[model samples]
Target: MDKLTIIKIIHTVIWVFFNVVLFYLLYSVLINKIDKWVWICIGLILMEGLVLLLFKRMCPITVIARKYSDSTKDNFDIFLPNWLAKHNKLIYTTFFVPILILLIYRLISG
Candidate 1:
């Protein structure tokens, strides 16, 4: 592929890898409790949301991708404002609703 495509792939891979490692650490080490799995799951989901928001808004890799796309005339669009991109209320609600419900159920049942 071209330089732009290569850069985009690298950026995506790095972000995914970072998130996986971060979640692993959080679940395995930071909150080491069987009962905390619910909290861990919720935290991971929220972290994913935050990463999505960052990718949409102020991610350095996304900024680089935007620059490369602009220079090469690629069809990548990454020019979202920080507020709209990072704090997408709809996405946040959609992702967390199920997790919140599960957490509440677990708490009440247990």
Candidate 2:
């Protein structure tokens, strides 16, 4: 397989992994199951956030993918649809921020 295809597969896998983590976090908040895993999920997401900040808000994988493909479309580097690729951060952050806030409330109110 070509480098660009490989990178797209890897990036999509990473995206799905984070989606699972985020969903797990949401489930924890909904069910009031605050545990070590919840903290771990938050840590993982925060680390991803830090990486984005360091990379000027682009996924490092996407930056690497640029070397292999010249496509300017948002989903050029990954398997997501164009609109989702364009607004992925906004969509995920909408779910994450509130889940985070509720988790914090659960932690503090205990």
Candidate 3:
């Protein structure tokens, strides 16, 4: 009901969505032959674990969420800017960067 609660909910939702998307993309690229439902479940579990690790490791999103949650306290209208909204870009890139490099290396070697 309060602003902070609303902001926290929104932040959590966004983070969860981003995690799911990232996992789905990576799974599709690396495990395209797998069953969709099984991959989905695996991705969900992996993402949840990654989120918890991020939170424990002081990841930027977790840090921002903590700060916003603390600052808003009881506010609900917290709006994140584009940069913050794209905060997980680095994480996603980490998943793809090596793949890209490997592809490039194969092409060059061949």
Top candidate when judged by lDDT against the true structure: 2
Query: Per-residue alpha-carbon lDDT of model 3 for 34-86, expressed as tens digits?
Result: 34653464556467558767677434444555644544322222344545444
Which tens-of-lDDT digit does each residue in 21-55 have in candidate 1?
A: 44554444333333555456557666766875877
**What local distance difference test score does each model get?**
0.52, 0.95, 0.53
Q: Candidate 3, 25: how far from true, in Å?
A: 1.1
Q: Which residue pairs overlap in candidate 1's backbone?
A: none
Q: How many residue pairs clash in each candidate?
A: 0, 0, 5
* Candidate with best TM-score: 2
Window of ten residues with lowest summed lDDT in model 1? 72-81
How many angstroms is residue 67 displaced in model 1 relative to the true structure, after the best TM-score fit? 1.6
TM-score of each: 0.42, 0.97, 0.38
How do the residues 23-107 of candidate 2 rate in per-residue lDDT, one tens digit apiece? Answer: 9999999899989999899999999999999999999999999999889999998999999999999999998999989988988
The CA lDDT at 72 in model 3 is 35
